[model samples]
Target chain A: MPRDGTATRTRILDAAEHLVIENGYAATSVDQVLSRSGSSKGAFFHHFSSKQQLARALVDRYVEGDLAQLEGSLEATAHLTDPAERAVAIVRHFEDLGDEIMAAQSNCLYVAVLTERQLVDDGTSDEIVRAVETWRVRIAEVLKEALAATGAHDVDADALADHLFVTFEGAYLLCRSTGDSRHMRTQLATFRRLLQSLLGPTT
Target chain B: MPRDGTATRTRILDAAEHLVIENGYAATSVDQVLSRSGSSKGAFFHHFSSKQQLARALVDRYVEGDLAQLEGSLEATAHLTDPAERAVAIVRHFEDLGDEIMAAQSNCLYVAVLTERQLVDDGTSDEIVRAVETWRVRIAEVLKEALAATGAHDVDADALADHLFVTFEGAYLLCRSTGDSRHMRTQLATFRRLLQSLLGPTT
Candidate 1:
């Protein structure tokens, strides 16, 4: 009887994500992933050709989930015609997501990659950059739309978008280092408040 | 004539800091530090008991310099009697610091330590937390003073202070990952703008 290759692959990825988040990519070894997942060396290799490949797979999967959440928020907010409301709603949506992540007590894979960029291969590194760029571009788009809708003339949508992203990354780091989950909530809320004030009252 | 042991220790630390910032603490070896600094294993062991000790020393040195800069900024802005102007000046001071960091093409050691927290010893880790707490408390003090002086009643000074720190950590991570120095300047500027808007015209 043949075993489920997909199940094995999922186990490896789950374990790898946890380890990478806990120990970072450089310190997380394939053997550790195998032992944690209870998968054999053969199963590990069957799923991932190399540690670098495993890293790539993990990043791709994370990117998929991340972008899905972003799209989900966009779809959920698509009904609102007001760009400002849509933008705020989208941020609130992520705030809710932050709540879920805090409840889960998981750190971000991207932060791990960002700090351990030189340890991973070029292709995997490029994916990290590409994924963050996608985020930057998407958030900037909505903000640009919101700024125009509000007739705001003094704000830079791009910079504000970067600020939002920066807050998420920074707050996550603080939360991880301090083990305070509310750090994320407070930081995101403050960003939202500042953003609202910058954009003025939603018209 | 005995060589200057202090000079040797400084060389090791300088090389270690660069490697840790570039490759992370776990991936960087004592041998690599020795090779980079042109110091022998005997010299390395003479200065530091272990890699963990080196990590602790690195963080201590970093924290000392970090707090010095913070104090230096506070001192330079001490002449501004108005709390609101003082707060704004403090933030502007950090924005200028961001510009300097970008120009130098360096990243934060605390961020590297945060991501590699598990690999470092408890004492080193505690120092990292303590250093950041000092920052949080100090900034919160100024922000609280500013808030009271501004007659603002709705703001949470502590949360706002955390926002500033979070922006620095997050913006630095993004800059490292993307190799875009402008990200820091733009993020810090936007933060300063939002903070000013929150504090209300700095009267």
Candidate 2:
């Protein structure tokens, strides 16, 4: 695509994401997307046929680009060779996602869609479920590596990873609601102590 | 009040709770609640003058009754006198609440109310926050006692309790969406290990 077309596409998606972030996927309209993006109906129809199609593309972009990039942050720090620092970095990774999470508001889009899965079909729901499972899985992998490096056989590394993801996601919701960053800090501190205890005086 | 009046009041509140749970608070209305409850307008006003009042009452009841009751389960096992078991019980309280949470299907009433606090300030949202804080305080107290009992003095027990509450509340939302109780087990296991680590040498 040419520069203009690429800009139009980016603009449309940015507007669509903002709208969904602001009003949820079900409530946002293509017309609103165009209005915000300054794209014409012809432009929208040319790029995407329907709102559902646009949503699919938006989700795809969100997954591969945004979520992937965030995961990459942890992956980048994974080879640090220090379990304690790795664990701390893992917590901080979640703490940093505050911006994307805030932009998306208090609930994850996948979560919101999951709650309303009955409106869709089992197949679509499963796809969304897989996306979410993948999220936790990635976090778990990082945690598993960190735990193994420290030889923390006492800690249920996989369980801790899953629990931390759920806990962090949940804490993010509370943090956003109460406008307090303290909850995230509290969770991180507890997570750190848990990791230390699991590893037992790591070198 | 007469028996009939009391019964009617109970029916009305139950219906309202269901409506609020089934539909978001703003999406639900007084007439809709009345229709759902099989009550007339006069009867609804007789019980509660307004929808805002009804939500406030629900928040109050939920905070005072339902959420406050969670500690009772932990208290029941307090005599175990073991930090490890007490820690497991604390996490189990949240795990057990998962079923009640799913049945309610409100998908985080606290989030919903907090999400729309500006629209309805009849003390509903504030009550929800208060309720959460109360849980944190209570948990912290139990944890303090547990810490002392188990001789774990290094960690800050109050912060740990607050983190657990926030994390559990957050996880419950996601678990309800996924309909997966397994994660609750993961959470419990993590909680146990963290306690063992903090308390050290459970045997």
Q: Which portions of model 2 show Cα errors greater than 4 Å?
A: A1-58, A81-88, A96-128, A142-157, B19-23, B26-53, B78-88, B93-106, B117-123, B145-154
The lowest-lDDT stretch of 10 consecutive residues in candidate 2 chain A is A115-124
Chain B TM-score against the true chain B, candidate 1: 0.93
> Lowest-scoring 10 consecutive residues by lDDT in candidate 1 chain B?
B116-125
Candidate 2 DockQ category? Answer: acceptable
Give lDDT tens digits, candidate 2, residues B84-189: 5676576766656655645555455554454453423345567666766777777777788777876667778766776666666556555654567456545655
RMSD values, in order shown: 2.3, 4.3
Which pairs clash (backbone N, Cα, C closer than 3 Å) in model 1? none
Model 2 backbone overlap count: 1
Chain A only, candidate 1, TM-score: 0.92
Top-TM-score candidate index? 1
Show where candidate 1 strays beyond 4 Å: A1-3, A149-152, B1-3
Tens digits of per-residue lDDT for model 2 on A36-127?
Answer: 99999999998998777777677667666645755676787768667666766666665565455455554444533433333234333444
Worst 10 residues of 1 chain A by lDDT: A116-125
| Residue B131, model 2: Cα distance from true site in angstroms | 0.8
